[model samples]
Target: MLESYSRCWTEIDYAAIAHNVEEIQKLVGDTKIMGIVKANAYGHGDVECAKALQKVGVDFFGVSSVDEALHLRQNGIHDSILILGYTPPEHFHYLIEENIIQSLVSYDYAQKLDAYAKEAGTKIRCHCKVDTGMCRTGVIYQVQEKNMDQILAEYRMEHLIVEGIFSHFPVSDDLGQESAAFTKKQIELFEEVCDNLRKEGINPGIRHIQNSYGILNYGDLKMDYCRPGLLYMGVTSDDAIPIASKPDFIPILSWYANVSLVKWIQKGQSVSYGRHFIATKPTKVATVSVGYADGLHRLVSNCGLEVLIHGQKCPIIGNVCMDQCMVDVTQVDDVKEGDVVVLVGRQGDHRVTIDEISRKSHSINNETLSDIAGRVPRLRRREK
Candidate 1:
């Protein structure tokens, strides 16, 4: 028998992962894919997601922190791990020893890394990040032309190897022509930087610029490599931008919980905190043992969100509690204690997607998935 804890669990479909990888691979043919598994595979269970992605032939694992990389290493994930976020200078030695790739955004930081690599007597593989107008991370574009050249020419020591050059698209989701123009500008600037480096007798390998949105909408920007994060989880940036010819994606994660209690709430009685829901008619309410604390956004309270109870969609009543939520199962006549309720994922012909939740919560799909905490046990789905 399945453990009781499995009643409230996440089911990850490995085959879906393979399908998504093949789809993206076809989209960016011959270019390598750096599967962004940062934020614990965007809250889909990091070690397991990385393992599944590696099985599907992901070329590299991208993470945000040293600790995240170490977690992958601890799980026996030995593939090339790239720490895309800023790593403190003090942690350079640790990055060097782990054989993990790091992104350098500043010349001074690059020099610090060079000094450490020289002391260690080994060449450190590092990628140079050009801002290209993101204004978030990386070296700003206006200064990059001169500063990048100096970093590669003067600041670079014998022990530091320039492995890759990349930039990010700030508004790939905004499909307006202006957004396209800006993206084109960034890509052009990145290409010019590469050209300049080559002219100076320095070849920084793996020039990449396409992100998840860029990979789908802008085929022209898919260069030597593509970094795809959210697409791996079957989330598209914009519904208006059609991805018609690609392989169909299956959402890998499913959220489910069993009914802890089933009873009748008298007419006029309210449910949950703040008495947000009042029963005009007698209501059959079922309490499920999972709530906002478990990563269900509080915004889902009394909104358009619905869950499948006995394969029928039921409205969520009142405010969702920190550890529990009540759903009006009035129409699901057969629902009782111990019946299964699926908050996210398929149930019969009905389904609830993270996209739906995101729309209701006025939040991004990436945040919705990644915020599902350690409290939820992820059950690995077996092959049929």
Candidate 2:
């Protein structure tokens, strides 16, 4: 059995991450890969995962903010990093000082960043973001003439070097006819904007429009780079429709906790805080050393959530508490305190996946993974 000094911990398979990178490489023949390490590699430990990715030849990284990018740079990552989201104008100097590329979200934002960079007597590298259809960020692509003028103004900024242009796909993962058509239009619009820039004697240094889903469903699109987040993490959302040619990616994260106490409960006795669960019969209950505070979602309590104990599925008996939760272990033979409990990993013939947890919690895989608190230590594992 695995033992941890902490209440719970996550085991990261570096080998599996490397294998997933290789699989992504196969799809994107010569194009560059921007390993999205934002949100601490989706709560898989950014620095460690970034180091593992660097070992596999991923030279470019995408982060959500300047802090995340700086975190990588400070941790000995010398690779090129682009902030895919907003960065305060006050931190524009940091981007230039750190040689980190900032995403030009809007023309106004660009002007503000340029002003800061100009005052600093330096130029900040940037990737122009076009709102093709996501309508979230970036300069709107619907107004082509106005959008072209705005992007041209950004490229013309002396203190801002627009080194690349990219956009997002809102529904590229959905292969249904309507959704697919909409995605196609988004790609076309992004390309058209890039082409327009080129026509104005401006070099849109690196043109990339593919995200994780875009890479999977439209891998044939010629682009200079592809940013993959969830795909690189080796798991997709439970609702994500899989393509026939989807590469085989190994899941890289496993969560485990130790059984803290074991006790038998009489019939009609409830457990935990709320009297939500009453023992129909004499049942054995084991309190796990993990709960909501440990990244175990309280929503999954009594919602068909189970943990593997003695290689058997034990049902969560009551409402999950902040620091602990109880699970019925009557069916498990010889289950006792100090036993290893598989919260989100394989145990014998059974495996509880992130997708399973997401489904039970009525959330997405990204939330389920990133919701894991920082208190849970992420230990790296290289499977042989």
Candidate 3:
């Protein structure tokens, strides 16, 4: 019997991740795959996923913040980890000390980091972000070209190493008119900058731009490296960008819990708080040890949500409480306590995908995964 320390736990499949990487490798061919382990590997568990990715020969690991990079480094992850977002000026010291690379988005940021590195008597590595179309970060490609050139030259003098130059696409996952047109323009602007720099003998170490969606859609326009975040975590983009051709992804996350209580309810009786679900007839209700506190969305409570219990699809009854939720298991014969109930992923012939839950909750799978509380331990499993 499968058991867990807590009734609610998130199971991660390292073997499935490896398989996903292998499948992506077949499609991308030589284009490098930068493992996107940001947001705790998109809530699948960061350090664990990083180690698994390392074993499979991933090119690089990209994180959202400096703290995330530090966690990986502290856990003996010596591979190159790029902080995709901003790092505070006060903590720039760790960047040099830990050999972590940062994305230099603005001239002021670059200047501050250069001075910080010099004061520490160490060189800092950074990638200049080109704001081709995405206005979120980086220098605007058109108006800031001259400014970028001067900054690059000044960086060399200040002993700041420009390890790479990259940009982000706003709508690389969408095939819609505006998204495609804008993405194409962004790609053009990004490439032109690289080409212009090289023409003037300015060689930015490594070039990369494509994200998970880009890898799926515009893969043929491969650059020096690509970032695979959601794909590596075993789910597609929320945008539902149609794929041209690629390997099928294996879902790497499975949320499970044990049945804590089971009892028969008489007709006209209600289950859980607020009397949300009233039984019209005799019903067997199995209470699961998972609730909103355990990353189960509150919206799912009192909603028509089903979980796999004893290889049977059981509908959730009443409102989901802080510690548990009740499910109708009357149809599931011989139902008892301690049965494994799957909230996400498959069990027997019945399956409840995270995508399904996301749709039901009117949210994305990534956001729902993030809601999974820290109390829910993520157990890594590799099926032999």
Please provide TM-scores, in order, for all candidate models, with all chains considered together. 0.93, 0.96, 0.93
lDDT of each: 0.79, 0.86, 0.83
On lDDT, the stronger of 2 and 3 is 2
State which candidate has the highest TM-score: 2
lDDT of 1 by residue, 191-274 (tens): 877887788787868788888887876755558889888777776643435542454666777888889999998989999999
lDDT of 3 by residue, 32-65 (tens): 8889899888888888888888888885899999
Off by over 4 Å in 3: 142-157, 239-241
lDDT of 2 by residue, 168-217 (tens): 99898888899998998888888888889889999889888888888888
Which pairs of residues collide in model 1? Answer: 42-370
* lDDT of prediction 1: 0.79
Model 2, stretches more than 4 Å misplaced?
Answer: 143-146
Sliding window of 10 residues with minimal summed lDDT for model 1: 237-246
Task: Tell me the RMSD of model 1 versus the true structure.
Answer: 2.2
